[model samples]
Target: MSEIPANTRPLEGPAPRLKAPAGATDCHIHLYLPGYEAQPGGPKIPELATVEDYRKLQQWLSLERVVVTQPNAYQRDNRALLAALEQLGPDTARGVAAVTPDTPDRDLQAWHDRGIRGARIMNLPGGAVTHADMLAVEKRIRPLGWHLMVQFNGCQLNDYIDNLQRLESEYIIDHIGKFMPPVPADDARVDDILRLLDRGNAWFKICAGYEASLTSAPEYADVGAIARRVIAHAPERIIWGTNWPHVGVSRDNYPSDADQLDVLLDWATPEQQQKILVDNPARLYGF
Candidate 1:
């Protein structure tokens, strides 16, 4: 085990000036417990985030649905993530789990029955899955009606475009594929993302703007432009999330839950906002 941050900040902040529509969902977030060890050779996301702590955030943001992603901190150890889904209740909360290609069929079915709608493969540095395992993992989850939620660098997506198109399961590209240095609006990466959305089997999470932006938080202007382009390309495929507890984020730069939600107003129209925050997530997560 490694040292985890205290995360003393209250989950309180200014209310988003734009209220989230009914059934609005935070499609990406995590739960962390102290003293838990990361998988060997995996990225460290040591932090103390709990479901109860996140309830305060849910109230602050007025979001009714959530999807708890199994974090790299507890790679392949989904006990905490499963507990969170139970605590949040299956009716309003769903989960995206981390599993190896070898994870048993029985276990996968159990997780699916308990409200896990997706399996995530973090291809970023220190992520659990390798490039070679992407399709194998997708094959494992396909039978369960779960999509593959992939997190990777935008610049690298083109490399896997052929594999992505061939996967039998529907897929979600996390954080607009987390484009680095926030590329130009017309960058080829943007077109690749658009092409993925055009396939009708893919979805995008319009979360974690700060991670992809060269600009700092509260504004995140450059990443916001890319997100806007994604929305313009396909509002129906875009869903919103706060990336709460902001694991691995420096506390000084970690944003308020409300501030993160407010950024969406700039990204979409009120009707588009409704689709991103509510309807789209409902369809994706089965809320």
Candidate 2:
């Protein structure tokens, strides 16, 4: 196994169960890249989710492709995530990087070579991310044909939908709009998600983000609703994942890798299920 920063690392509990169908991909997952110190006010290293742990988890899930997301902990130093892509190799996996406006073209090209199709601008901690920040990053990444993968919560994407949609780059939503089911369609924020889909290039990940609060087997209401709503908006763009190791976040029901896959099966029909689990990601990530 490769050495990660000591402070941020995986707490391996059990060997994971992959059990996914052939050509399946987990649209979302994180690689803990600790040890890289951050400048003041920059992103902090949350917890490390090792690639080696995920590789075994992928085998357990029966998946061949994965999208490695750089977490808040590593800040903007994506070398760790890039290294994880290198570990994943050329044929099987790809990544979505977390980069700032200042990331060099060489570095971006380097990531492209390592199977990165996009750059991420995580905005999960409320209004901390500004549109100006996104606009600046847009200028940096769109020219490369890379998409923008965003992680945010609160008010759906309605607040930023127009700006997000108008951009030329493809927009991939994180965690089913972070909608909590049984919450009112008005407050449910499904409209905001639907609006992004109306733009055509926008996509969504039917993932187990901690905010969704999933129960292992028999399913959880939040994630199932998220999947249903996303598929309703754009089944072709919807995808599934475990968000492995859970990160700085925790879950209500800690599902094993298999437990997570079952969430998708429960939410969509067999064919749509294949789109969420296998086909959609292959098209989006070119897997």
Segments in model 1 whose C-alpha atoms lie over 4 Å from true places:
1-6
Candidate 2 contains a number of clashing pairs equal to 12
TM-score of 1: 0.94
Q: Mind giving the per-residue lDDT tens digits that candidate 2 earns over 1-287?
A: 33444422333334433346788887788776445454344544444566666776776666788888765555666777788888888788788776677778998887888888877766655223345588778778887778888766634556776678677778788776665433443444676677767878788887764455544344666556556766865788888877776654544444556666776656777778777878888887887
TM-score of each: 0.94, 0.83
Model 1 C-alpha lDDT per residue in residues 125-208, reported as the tens digit of each score: 766665578888888888888988888888777787888889777888898668876788789878988988898989989888
lDDT of candidate 2 at residue 209, scale 0 to 100? 41
Overall local distance difference test of candidate 1? 0.84
What value does the lDDT take at residue 158 in candidate 1? 78
